[model samples]
Target chain A: MTYDWTLWIVFILIGLATTLPRGSFIILGERASLPEGLQKALRYAPAAALAAIVVPDVVLVGGVVEVLNPKLAAAFAAVLATQVSRNPWLPFIVGMGVLLGLRHFL
Target chain B: MSPSFREGAREGFRVFLPLSVGLIPWALVTGMTMGGVGFTPLQAMGMNVIVFAGTAQLGTLPLIAAGSPVWLIVVTAFVLNLRFIIFSAALARGFHGVPRAERWLAGHLLTDGVFATCLEKMLSHEDPRWRLGYYLAPSLWSWLLWQVFAFCGVMAAGSIPKSWSLEFMATIALIVLLVPMARLRPMLLAALTGGTLAVLLRGMPLRLGVIVAIIGGIAAGFAAERWQGAAR
Candidate 1:
C-alpha cells in the first residue's frame, strides 16, 4: 500500500503528545510540585488505569464474560506468584508458561 | 549532571534487562497488529522506533485499518496518551536537580512502566542517580525488547495465527505487574472505581469512556487519600 502522509502526520503528532508531558516535566525541572492531592492521586492512577484496561480484556471472550478463561487463570496464577515471591520475573515467566500450555490444550 | 552520562547509560541497560520478557509479548502483539492492519514491516518498525508507545500505537492501528482520516487518528492517539502529562509532572519533580540535557534524554525514555517503577524506587532511595538507575534499567530493556519482538512479528505477520490471543497475554501480563503495586487503600479504590466506570462507560463512542474512567479513578483515589489524611 502507498504511504499516507496523513497517517504519518497523525503518528508523529501522537508520539509528540505522548512524549511531551514526560519530557516537559523533566525539562522544566522542579519549577513546581504536583498539587498534593493530585500527587497522592497519581500514586494510584497506574494501578487503577491498568486494572481498568486489563480486567475486561482478560475476562471477556467471544462476547461472553468469563473470568475463567485461560488468560484470566494465568493472570491469577501470576498474581499469586507476585504476592508470594514478590519477584517480577518469576510470575511473568510462570504466567506465560501457564498460558502457553493452556493455549496448546485449548 | 544528576547522573553521569556513563551512569545513565548503565542505568538504562539495567532497566532494560528485567523488562525485556514482559515487553516481548507486548511488542510482538503490536507488530502483529500493525502487520495485520496491512502495514509493511518497514512502516511497523518505523512506528516502533518513533512512536514507541504501545497503547497509542495499538489504538491507532484500527484507525489505519479502517482508512480513517489521518488527522483524526493522530488526534485520537494524542488524546489516548494524555496520561503522560501526569507522569511527566511527577518525574520532573523527582529529577529537578538534573541538568537540562540529562533531563531531556531521560524524558525521551520515560514510559508508564518505567515511571512507576522509578517512582517507587525513588521513594525508598534518596539518591536521584540510584532512582535513575532503577528507572533506566527496566525501561531500556523494555525498549529493546519491543523493537526486536515487534520486528519479528512484522516479518512473520502472515504466519502468526490470529487465534493466539496475544492481546490476552498482554492484558494478563499487565494485570500481573499491577497487582503488586496496589498496596494502598487509595490505590485499591482507584482500581475498583476505574474498572467499574470503564465497564459502565464501555459503550461510549471514540473510547472516551476510557478517558472518563481514568479521570474518575484518579479523582476517587485523590478523594480517598484526602479523606484518610483528614481522618488521621
Candidate 2:
C-alpha cells in the first residue's frame, strides 16, 4: 500500500471499468444486447450512486451525522439554483459561493 | 485529413466550442481533487489521463483517501460509469455504416456532451456530412480540454492552501452534477432514498454503506416508478 500501488491498481481497474462497459456494445456490435429492464435500471444507477456518496458527505462531518452545517445549506441552494436556471454553471457558482460565504460567516 | 473530415472537424469544433465552456470547471475540479487526495501532480494527471471519467474520478478518489478496500473502490467507479454502456449501445445503433475501427475509437471518445451532440447532428441527420470528421473533432477536443485543464488544476491545487477545502470543490462539482440528473421523479426518489440509507448505514465497514445505499436507492426508485405507472 505504500508505493501507492493501491491507487494505481484502482486506476487500472477503473480504466478497465471505463473501457470495457463502454466498449461492450461497440464490440458486441449487432449480436449481443442488454435487456430492456436492465437498460431502465442502468439509468437510475448513477443517480443512486451519486446520492449515496454525496448524502454522507454533506450530513456527516468526520463520519458523524451533522446536518446543520454549511455544506447542507450550500447543497440546498445549489438544488434551488438548478430549478431557477438551466445554465449548468449557476448551481456550482451559487453552491460554492454559499459554502465559502457561510464557512466565513457561520 | 480529407475534405469531408476537415468539414466535419470544423463543424464539430464549432458545435463543441459552446459545450466546452460547461466542461471547464469540471475538468479543473477533477484535476484539483486528484491533487487534493495527496497524489503528486504527476500521479494526479496520470489518473486523469488514464481514468478519463469525471464522476468516477471524483467519486472514488475519496474512497482511496478513506482506506476502503480496493474492490469497493473499483465497484463504485464501475457503477458510476455504467451509464456509458447505454450510451455505447445507442451510439452504435445511431450512426450506421461506420467502419469497425472508427466505432472503437468513437466509443472510447464518447462523453455525455458528445453523445448529445452526436444524437443531434451525426446520428439522426443521415447526412454524408455526418462523417467521422463531425464526431471526432468534438470528442478529441473534449479529451484534450479535459487533459489540459485537469493538468492545470493539478498544478494550481498545489498552490492553494488545503484549509480552503479545495477538495470541497469536488463535492460541489458532484452536487452540481447530481442536481441535473435528479430532475425526474424516479431520479429524485432514488437520490432521496439513497442518501437516507447512506446516512443510516454509515456504520458499515469498508465503506460498504455506499453500495448498500446505492442498491436501496435504486430499489426505491424502481418501486416509485412501478407505482407511478400503475397510477397512470
Tens-place lDDT per residue, model 2, A1-105, is 233666677788888887777777866677778888888888888999998888888888887888799988888888888788877667777877888899998
Chain B TM-score of candidate number 2: 0.91
**Full-model lDDT, candidate 2:** 0.81
DockQ of each candidate, alpha-carbon based: 0.42, 0.59
- What does candidate 1's lDDT look like per residue over B1-232, in tens digits? 3455457547656655565565666676677767766676777788888888886677566556656555556654564555676777766666745567767667767777787656754456556675566666666677787889989878777575665544344454456556756778888888778877767776677766666787788788888888998999
Per-model CA lDDT versus the true structure: 0.68, 0.81
lDDT of 2 at A12: 85
Runs of candidate 1 exceeding 4 Å displacement: A1-10, A30-33, A61-71, A84-106, B1-40, B54-103, B111-146, B149-159
* Docking class for candidate 1: acceptable
Candidate 1 lDDT, A1-106, residue by residue in tens: 4466555666677778667766776777767556665556556656666766665556667635776777777887878887888554566567767887897999
Give the best candidate by DockQ: 2
TM-score of model 2 (CA atoms) = 0.90
Candidate 2 lDDT, B1-232, residue by residue in tens:
6687788889888988988888887888888877877789778877887888888889888777777788888898889889999988876665466677777777767788887887666656564435578888998999999999998889988897776666666677777788878888999999999989989998898778889999988888888888999999
Give per-residue lDDT, candidate 2, residue B10.
Answer: 90
